[model samples]
Target: MTRYQPRHTADVRDTGRRLLVRGGAAATVMGAATLGLPGAAQAALPMLRYGSRGSAVVTLQKKLRTLGYSVSTDGIFGPNVLRNVKAFQRRAKLGVDGIVGPNTWAALDRATSGGSEPDPQPEPSDPKPEPSDPKPEPKPTGSRPMLRPGSRGSHVTYLQRQLSSHGFWVGSIDGSYGHLTSQAVMCLQKTYGLGRDGVCGPNTWSAVGRISRPRAAYYSGNGIEIDLRRQVLRVVEGGRVKWAFNTSTGTSRTPTPRGTYRNFRRVNKMDYSPLGKLWRPVYFYRGYAIHGSTSIPGYPASHGCARVSNAAMDYIWARNLAPIGRSVRVY
Candidate 1:
């Protein structure tokens, strides 16, 4: 067995919420776009910027306080308020001008209150021939329910729905937990920095609650998307993700370059200097390939390459998935 140290972090943002739990606990967790529109009384809230003050400022301050910001909710626009606003702006990837105008207000409203997640991407084609599973009814749980291989129920169906909604192949929605569903759940667990236990529990359930759909590079084309954050390598054919693989990408020191690239060379098998051996290596970036590893951890561990399991790499080559001239996108 490939041995690598496991590192798990409780990345639940102060504002990020849990999945399934409702009531007052719901306030402690998140729902999709719950913050999208400001509160009912926020329609008249003024555009706030540096030096602006009054009830509108109070509204912004209260929103910030509710979002776990350290700023006071005193309704006075001050240095503290500006700092929190700018930080929120940066975290949300909105304009960093610190001005709470229409755009900023809209973004802040859409911001995740706790445990921030990526915005949902456009839904891809259904991976299975059958109808997609219906959404599961939510309920509070005493403890995080763990769904592993051999598990079966409506929850399994719900889990399958979550995976397919995010473009991962869960095989089918028959509510039977099997290898394919296990693989899909593993990919999802890996993507969100959760433990690669092939078990869907609270953290995974919460992650599934907030689906981050991956997009193709251009408006339309067959391509490969290597998402570092999601740790997924998506095979995009005709501008939609047809398949996905859990990939272990580069570390912080040797980060994978973010851009569009193409396969330039390949090797059936090679014994690299420190990497030992790479299988079905298809090179795109310098020395970096969508290759195979006996030990593809859930997190970033490679020097700079995108790595899948040996079998997955074989599947890619067998199908001529990453032929020369095909786009490989890392974003």
Candidate 2:
């Protein structure tokens, strides 16, 4: 008979097993592809901007240094880094957003590969006059921009650093012109007998250049002095004004006691009194404490207590500046 011989059973089983194995392999690969496996899971470059801080910032700073940018690799993307980044962007003919994005990264890489010279550092329109200069030069309004509560960028950082150097507390040296900066500006205005508008106008900038560290009225030892006339508080140590804060003393109805007293009590948390909420109060006299308040205006607006910002009060608590047995002098 011409009938074909039956295929071997073992051969049939082997062929089926091979097909199954190939099918399973294909399924696994397909599944991996569907789930975006190994190849597609690689991390993309991060977009870095101002206020960024971390290993990524360090890497960016290193790359900037390789391109001869004069930026400190401190991992903090502050004003210096922002300025350098803007300069790089301008050189690359990219948008000067001060943000290190993919395009900026590519430009930096291309520039480094080509070994291009670093761009010239940006010159300030109105260079800050030295504090020790006998004649403080006036920065004309036409050259300098007026900075208010919403203003931002390197200029705000400059203002913050200037205020800090003058012993005024403006919270952090961040570039954002927030409430603390406004309060510090107001304090400066009050000290210089300018209009307390809390805006850095031409007159305010003039005052900033002329402002100097205030001398403590009481040069005995470590003490807290509140100048009601200036609406400022000075933390004196070793007979020198260590730090100053914008403070609001009592109103006309209830004026702060003008005397020297010892801080007998300290309330670490919020204290509810008949007048209002007192945050981290350091009581110097009867119902009169140098405490923190939310409404510390440029002028007197408190209820017989020297009102400072809540952040200032926290700083006092942290440094033990206003502790029990500390002298409190009000003038």
Candidate 3:
């Protein structure tokens, strides 16, 4: 079972709005270009950048934030905002294709005022398929949702979209948690040394936002991502954030937990031992660990121990921590 988390204020609402309005989909607001010409060009908003600092980004961010998207109006298009966008898109049932196109814009317009959800079912305009002389190339394998930030829909879709923004492709944003999404999620878990289950919950989303920040590094085929606000751990690897699980810290957990902790050890596969004080085997470190549990339910679940899934334990066992001496820090 994979855990997930949300990264925004609870006051936020899921008002599915299209961010883009295409040429014939809605009324147009045209403008003229330079050279003393009228009606020369049409104006459209560009794709929002992550952690962007500007008026446009701020306006968009505030709007999204108000609508229950976990994005900040910090004038920067950060990971949080991207997650928000993906959430909005998903709820609207628009293509989880991640791009902020006309369909997205139209939805956004309705979302701002707490409007009702539009019908996202595919239209049957039935354009005739053009015959191609050359055969089309085979599509890529693996199902990663093309979801972007601010899409509206189910929590699962929301989680998948957030993961995609943080460099983990979870397959087509079809609102289904299939194998491809799970594989991408596992990649994130392996990188961060978390249990490699493919479920997206509060813990996983928190890790996704944190890893997007600076200072997250890849170590000996594994990595860790820390969320300052939520105080959790996210495993990553091979340029993708793998899995996210909970952890515990020292009595004076504040400053120490703030910094990143690199992999120091990996405990491998073991037989189920009821005699042990754990539901699963333990992976020990200097004084901490990434292990399994039968009682971990929420944040601060371990005694500075990084609790992970049994699968994650097995993965680390097979793949030793080659970067055992890397530094972990907090911001």
Candidate 4:
């Protein structure tokens, strides 16, 4: 005769405890193994950017050095690390945002584990692939509607991509033609001698296809050059215009001083002066700076400081493109 009975509470508790201990031990082993391998550890790593510090930064620096980048594993994410990250991102064909997010970390893992070469300075034009033949221009189809602000669709996204590929910053390709898209279109129009209507019409599309990289007046240094007449800003690197952005300089009442000056000071947050609020100001002269502004019209509208879109200023900050002591040439 057998008496069927449920397991006692103590027995169940003991079995549960044993399982928990075994699971924790297995987890500990897995964690140790993951930390031993770079690629495996990347999934649990946090994003590293400027000003980040700790053991994670050390890991990033070590991985960067492994990929032949000259970065010190001092557990500090400084300007040098930011530059190396940008260079690596550019090399990996990823967004050159200088932030070691998940995508960047994955790219680093692939490059290091796959036995890729060192971080060689790629040609400026390597990222941008130009068509071999410029003769056969892209004809606009009838279905291509004229893009204006507030238009939302894939066509607007295509327009944004084209403008970005042409080196005009359109903020983001969100499939919506917003203010930034309109501003970029106006910049393209201004560059190609087209009418600055801020509308993407047939002529604008044609110019987008035919235009080449805009050249800066001062092509001998790494700095920022502002074309007052064109209302455009050129970021020059190694004597080439790496990027161009639409800017609004000082109005006629108070002109942006025309001279070559190094960025003597900088404020990463919104700065208040007697004139108005300036976002992330990079001061070149006594009171004038290249700052982000809420209102950056196509013409000279600022009181004195050069005004660019807030997003553009952020891009400049992220890349350290206009660091302290960097030259700023205004003409």
User: How displaced is residue 280 in candidate 2, in Å?
Assistant: 1.0
TM-score of each: 0.49, 0.59, 0.30, 0.60
Each prediction's RMSD over C-alphas, in Å, is: 22.8, 17.7, 20.6, 15.0
Q: What tens-digit string does per-residue lDDT give for candidate 1 at 186-252?
A: 7877666788867887778888877676566552778898989878888888877766777888999
Residue 11's lDDT in candidate 2 = 71
The deviation in Å at residue 70 for candidate 4 is 32
Estimate, for each residue in 168-271, the C-alpha lDDT of model 3 and write its tens digit. Answer: 43434444554445544555554455654545444444455455422234444445654533444555565444444333332334222444555554333333
Off by over 4 Å in 1: 1-144, 149-166, 170-183, 189-198, 206-213, 217-219, 269-274
The CA-based lDDT of model 3 is what?
A: 0.44
Model 2: pairs clashing at backbone N, Cα or C within 3 Å: none
lDDT of candidate 4 over 117-158, digit per residue (tens): 333232235565632332332456555578898787667767
Q: List the lowest-lDDT window of 10 residues for candidate 4.
A: 130-139
lDDT of each: 0.68, 0.75, 0.44, 0.75
Q: Which lDDT tens digits does candidate 2 get at residues 1-331?
A: 3988666856755555565577785544544444444532112347899999998898888666555354666899998789778867866679999999877877776665554533322211225442342233335556668999889877777777677776777755556787778888988888889998889998998887777877889856899999999999998888877678899998999899998899998887889987689988989998889887778887899889999877667657755778788898899
Better of 3 and 4 by TM-score: 4
Shift of residue 318 alpha carbon in model 4, Å: 0.1
| Stretches of candidate 4 exceeding 4 Å from the true structure | 1-138, 141-143
Off by over 4 Å in 2: 1-139
